[model samples]
Target: MARTVTPEIVAHVKRFEGCKLFAYPDPGSVNGEPWTIGYGHTSDSFLKVRKGMTITQAQADAALEHDLNEVADAVERLVKVHLTDNQFGALVSFAFNVGNKAFANSSLLKKLNAGNYDAVPAELARWNKNDGKVMKGLTNRRAAEAGLWAKGSFVASNTVEAAPGNPIKDLTKPETITAAGGLLSGAAALATGSPAIQIAVGICLVVAVGVIAFLVIRKATR
Candidate 1:
């Protein structure tokens, strides 16, 4: 049976790609670049994206649905192994971001086909760089994809083991970082025993905590 892309996967792609109602040039492209509209829908789409073109949010959403369906179909055709919804969704998101050709040719796909599922996350993270620079957003997106890819398992759960230096283990969740920072700040304040230094550290910690809270709220609302 052909697998389908889930709504959760669609939302993940949308959150990362972001919706632009009006057509815009690819950020990394030079002049005369192919225009992208909707949720990263490009000129290659049948929807007729062009310079100066505009679309309603409803139109964008419709375009995204169409695009994801095509990508999902491509993923289904290319992947030979049976996949869970989460794995299929992760691959679709990857193909949506990197293009079907890249996804088809990727070492990630190769490893997946070879039943080396444990190596998939590292392979996904390798694509986090663009134009020879590492992008933090892509890194985060790939990590999320890896997490989803491993969500369910007949194969991944049973066969895959965390290798030494696994990136997943190294990924520090934001909440953990916040908690650790608080502890470190408290320790520093106590160790210094200098009133001025303690006051400065306290102010910095307050600002850091406030910023973290704001970011969390913003992400939640989004």
Candidate 2:
């Protein structure tokens, strides 16, 4: 039997990445308002639809352990085949934060479930933002998910066929640049030229001379 990855580890990873799990004090805030929840660091805790309670570490830890089974089951059905422990944990963490229905409808999960593994990274990249803009937090989360997606291998449920796609191999080729251009007009003054460079150099020398003269005058006056 395959070994199960625990939710405790997933929770720890999410927290370490600075996601808010519950409305409790920020990970280390110790005094901030209750903010995130679930096996994930879900930030939308104030929606009032599924209201959450402020929890102690003991409570949060227990909830994590309990939620692992639910998350793992969801991953099993969502994936085309068996996933590595890391892959399982990563998706489970995603589901924990985003909710099972969101996972169900996700382009990432749909691609995986359809065995269209090649498209997983694009789906992963789609999650690279909240509020329609890129952020460091989402970028890191997408990176983690992409790593997991690459690690997972698909095979027929009963047969022995390899599902295609290798993200690492796909990434090895350098990107092609089809178009290129130059600097904007009127930007040349900011640039250094033989004459411009000498002028800039002279300006620095004059500034230095002024500073030295002021210091010497101050000394003499003293």
Candidate 3:
């Protein structure tokens, strides 16, 4: 819990593999509006703020980032209080999608408190509905969250906290590695159930093979 919240976490959460971070009316404009909340950027939606709120995009972005930091902090606290590492990450991922309240009232929370790990996966599936509809996005998120949540137990030492002697250490700054790693992990999770990931991975594999072949041919000529 010594790691503080940093811009890393903000960027990680704000990162949209196939979604837009801004609010607009057209799906073609930004990978479609979010399944639950349509309008504005993903970041704006995350903060539950309205577009055209009299702030510059930059200012609005800052506010949204700050709100995410707040959410992350809240997640850390909840993790400390009850959930395990995987559970914490899962909850964060869930919050990133369904917003915080869903996690707050989630049966996952209840099950976790009762030390019922087996119940988490099922509870996660129940969160896939929005406004009386079964949204595909929510379904994907729930599955990803279930996977992440199943990772391990609560290990607060992995959390960012202040130095024992340094009270000035801010809790709002996420560590660089944690932020970057979390973003990459999120991408991996999204990619697992998304065609986009397969496409990207294929592209990368192809590029790697090409580079290796080029190197091999050059060595033979030498």
Candidate 4:
């Protein structure tokens, strides 16, 4: 089974990915093929985003956990070597951004599986492009992922600032709904689930209402 990433990693990913309440195009995606919403989430996620659609923060948070959990599961399936919490988190973040298929087919995966752990950071750096162009955002995200990867290795050093970003967000403040505690709560919950089945079915039920509400809101707006 895949290990869950710490809240810090979740925050690291959310910070770079950033969130928008409304649906928008993937800057990295050519022709804006897949619409995205609520923290760079796309049709590839559990909750599909479309043009003119908007999502509440609660729903967006749920979608993020669902997506991240899937990525963690993928990391578990593909990588044969052992990893520390930080190493695991770093890979999860990378896979989350690049897509499981891309990560699976990547030379980085091949190198890591070959036990060339030290080569991974450099391998990760090669992926700092999108649509045949190098993106500053992708470059920064890759650097962060590399830093995270290094931090968990024997090469861990002081220069590795604990991923650059805002501190972990407490989404359950009085300003938000109580049910929405799953913002961070959901990720932690799924990350620590005792049984393997919880990774899928349990997570969906937790956020099912949010999905329904989003549809209701979209219809009312139309």
Location of the lowest summed lDDT over 10 successive residues in candidate 4:
164-173
Model 3 over residues 1-222: C-alpha lDDT tens digits? Answer: 523444533444454323334444433335443421221234344454344324455655666555555566766755435555455556665565555776667677767667776787898898877667898877876776676666554434546853333222322235533654565575566567668777886576567546654554554455
lDDT of 1 by residue, 72-177 (tens): 9999998888788898899899999999999988888888888886787899989999889999999999999999988876452456763334333323567647
TM-score of model 1 relative to the true fold? 0.67
Top candidate, metric lDDT: 1
**lDDT of the structure predicted as candidate 3:** 0.56
lDDT of 2 by residue, 138-185 (tens): 787777766765664543655666455544433332331111011212
Q: CA lDDT of 215 in candidate 2?
A: 53
Clash counts per candidate, in order, are 0, 7, 22, 0
Sort by lDDT, best first. Answer: 1, 4, 2, 3
* TM-scores vs. true structure, each candidate: 0.67, 0.49, 0.45, 0.65
Ranking by TM-score: 1, 4, 2, 3
Best by TM-score: 1
Off by more than 4 A, model 1? 154-222
Quote the RMSD, in angstroms, for model 2.
Answer: 19.2
